[model samples]
Target: MQSITLKKPAPFEKYNQPVGDRYIDVLDGVRAVLVLLVGAFHIWQQSWLTPHFTLFGQRYSLDFLLRSGYIWVDGLILLSGFLLYLPYARAEMGKMPPVGPFLLKRFLRIWPSYALNVILFFFLAVEKYNGNGAYMAKDLVTHLTFTHTFFYDTYYGSPINGGLWTVGVEWWFYLLFPLLGRCYKKKPMLTALGMMTCAFVFRAYVSTLTDTRMWFNQLPAFLDVYALGFIGADAFVALRGKLLQSGKKEKRLFSLICLLCVILLVYIAKAQASSSGQEGIRLGQMAHRFPLALCLLVLMISACFASAGVRFVLGNRVMRFLSAISFQFYMYHQVLCVQIRERRLIPSVSETPNRDSEWPWQPVFTLCSFLLPILLGAILTYGFEKPIIRYFEKMRSRKKK
Candidate 1:
């Protein structure tokens, strides 16, 4: 197996260090923010709370923002692309990341807790299973192998959980990233353009289809987002020298630029969400991902080079801690939120359910949705995932000896 030995860089020597040698704490913050958006969006679906304020004699509500949370998922995908390619972003880098170690680490990162959690969910809540035994078996098989996104039944009618479709997409990205990374390393612009063009073609094909949902939800459809991420990583590495050398004036400019990029992203999202029908919605999502990814990258790179205040707001200990367990949190939250709705945990005067009404039970449901998954995610992160990874590392060490 490929060893876990990374090129060590001194924390203080930012300029002299290898681009991928050190941890980027801000990325954790980014992931944390995206995860929170996703969680809140899901919670909002249940609570039906349209958080709004009166500004300049106009009422602005976040209902549109919550409705467009899929864009945030695109951001997360791009961030993953940015992160994985950072090691290769440096032009002087010679050795490639080993395939075995990369796959091994990715596997350990995902499957251990995933398997454990899903298995528990399956057995403990067998009563909640949606279909017959055969159907449920098929779903379980597909989910465990990370191939559930390919099918209609499992992807749409997940008997156990549908929240993991993104995980399936991410696993495919992981498998393809090494090849894509090598191509990007050899020819950055060409490789990126090729990936984007391929994704564009795929989206175009999906748009032509009658039921675009199944086709649009696959990994191939999001190649442009990943390509943008790779480009972002490359650009950030190229710009780090200038960033580190920036004065107060430059930092202030960067902060302003980042803020503007965020505003543009909001505008684009609102405009894209204007489509009426289901088909139009799918088309708009496919059509608008590129621009959204572009905006996200701009914000990402700018935030990295922005003022200390911007960096602090975006990159702090709390954010990093949340991010550390973000995957588990993201994975478990849907079930937990559904449970909150299903079990009627929060008090409601509605005839049927809380989601059926507009009264703000946001506080109770939001806390349960965010806090419970976080607690579970933290426990799984420390209790299961870390131990599995450390065990593999220890085994690798002994083998080397």
Candidate 2:
């Protein structure tokens, strides 16, 4: 029995009204999940617990789940790429947004909340300065400018939230998005290919360096990730547009997308099992970032095109709430995990901060790691983020008048 008598999808507008952010609930849900994955990995970092099991007469390890957290950061990066270029993708069908308002909104949305957190953490982690005024000053400067990733001192071992490297990368992407978006608007596939090609060349160049770990995470390394996001956005819009246009319930298409997502997940786990290294897993990313990003794209698209029940499962009210505060959650979780260990908030017998914080504390610390981020993220999002955003928006309206 044929599932979908697939045919050329009608023009996008014939199905959906327009490309607007309101209906993209699944994206926020996925963002919530990605942030949680990253947070879990960081929590696991303090306690290197390998969770495995035996089933169906075969032993399998879920260890890669935590180990692969950093890779999921690429997923977040890809999401950023999708969002930044989504307007351009839609412009393939309709008019593009004015560059200035869009840029202003993006910067205003991120900077206020981010700057507050960075400054707060600066005070919290100031001990890392060790009375070395020079280093503290340098770290603060780089963070303020979003150039922290460009320097070794401010990157992997950064005193002010090592996880912040992603912010720096995203900021760079934002600064360049206008140009990238325009290029994509004019020639999307070509622009994506060009970005991916340049990224590969850049990675090859960086690999030649004496110690590539410090340099591997710079923005250029993840260009392909961003490029994939652009491609994914365009594809999602077109595919979903057509799906809606068919006016036929696509249970089969939904089933196929879900199966493909599952297959990709299994394939990735197998790849992780095959690879053995702690080196760039910081060392290993460059080798397979594209395929992984592609897989992420599939999952993201699948989520979007899923059945109403599946979409609601992912984009439910709870997920929406978490997604709203995901940025703050991500920023706070790892740092709080470290604080929990350092302050002995959870009892630990490991005198030297051992990998296994032992049974009670491991679970306790991980649980706190999960909860504290939400509490803090909610505080920042509700208390500070909303009011500041409204203020800027009002100013924009006044200017329009």
Candidate 3:
């Protein structure tokens, strides 16, 4: 079995480490922001209060902000691609680890907690199989194996957890990473563009199909977003020297340019959203997502070379702690949200007599939805996930010895 030599740490490694380092505090900050956006979006979607207010004579609902939060999932996917590709990129400079151990590491990192969630939700939430026995068996098999995303027929939507569909998408990406890494190492720009092109073509073709919902769940639809992340990691490694050598003025100007690109991308997405017809919506999403992905890449790159003020803000202790437990939070939040909604724990719009009133109950419901999941996530992460990971790590170390 082939094994890579793990490189010794540089003296200044703590100052500016690579993507797969033990800690990238800024990234934890990024995760904090992403997870909060996701949690807030979910809470706002289920809440009864309509938070509408006027800005510059234009009426906007807070729900619009919540709806836009879904875009952060793309950011999350991008981060995954960046981190996953980093080690392979490093290995290319030396030797690659045996494929079995690499794959095992990925499986162990994700599957234990995921299995727990599957079992919990199966007993607590999933409906009994009342459909055709054959189809039910197919759905169960696909869902269990994290291959549900590929099928158009069985379990097009998530069978167990709505948020878990991303797991299926990400698991495939993990499976494909070795091959993708080789192409990326050979021709970084060409490979990135090719992946983006394939994503666009797939999304465009899927738009014409009757099963658009299933298409949306497919990995091909989001490949560009993931590709942008790969490209971002490449760019950072390639450009770090020049970026660090540049003056403050130059760095600020570059950051401004990136920010403008993001704003422009948002405007384009808004235009597409307002366009009439389903074709317009699908085509718009396909076209707009690429640029948005690029924008996210730019922001991540900028954060790496950001000024002290920016770094300090992103590297806060609380944000880092939240980031540490983010996976657990992501896995559990939706389940709790669904439970809260089903149990009628919160008042609905229909139940309220005075719609104009300050809606006191909404805050309480929102707090419960946000806090309860986080509390449970803390338990799952510290109580279960970390222990299992440590045990496996110790076993692997013993084998190495």
lDDT by candidate, in order shown? 0.81, 0.77, 0.71
Candidate 1 C-alpha lDDT tens digits along 73-133:
8889999999888878864547887778898999988898888876877775666565478
Backbone collisions counted per model: 0, 3, 0
Task: Mark the regions of model 3 whose C-alpha exceeds 4 Å error after superposition.
Answer: 1-22, 48-61, 126-137, 152-159, 243-247, 254-258, 265-269, 272-283, 347-358
TM, every model: 0.91, 0.88, 0.83
Higher-TM-score candidate of 1 and 3: 1
Q: TM-score ranking from best to worst?
A: 1, 2, 3
lDDT of 3 by residue, 231-336 (tens): 7777776666456466667656655765675577567545554654655555556666777667777777676666544545566788778888889889888778
Using lDDT, rank the candidates from best to worst. 1, 2, 3
Which number leads on TM-score?
A: 1
For model 1, what is the alpha-carbon lDDT of residue 141? 86
Q: Total clashes, candidate 1?
A: 0
What TM-score would candidate 1 get against the native? 0.91
RMSD in Å for all candidates: 7.1, 6.7, 7.9
- Tell me which of candidates 1 and 2 scores higher on TM-score: 1
Stretches of model 2 off by over 4 angstroms after superposition: 1-22, 50-60, 92-94, 245-249, 349-357
lDDT of 3: 0.71
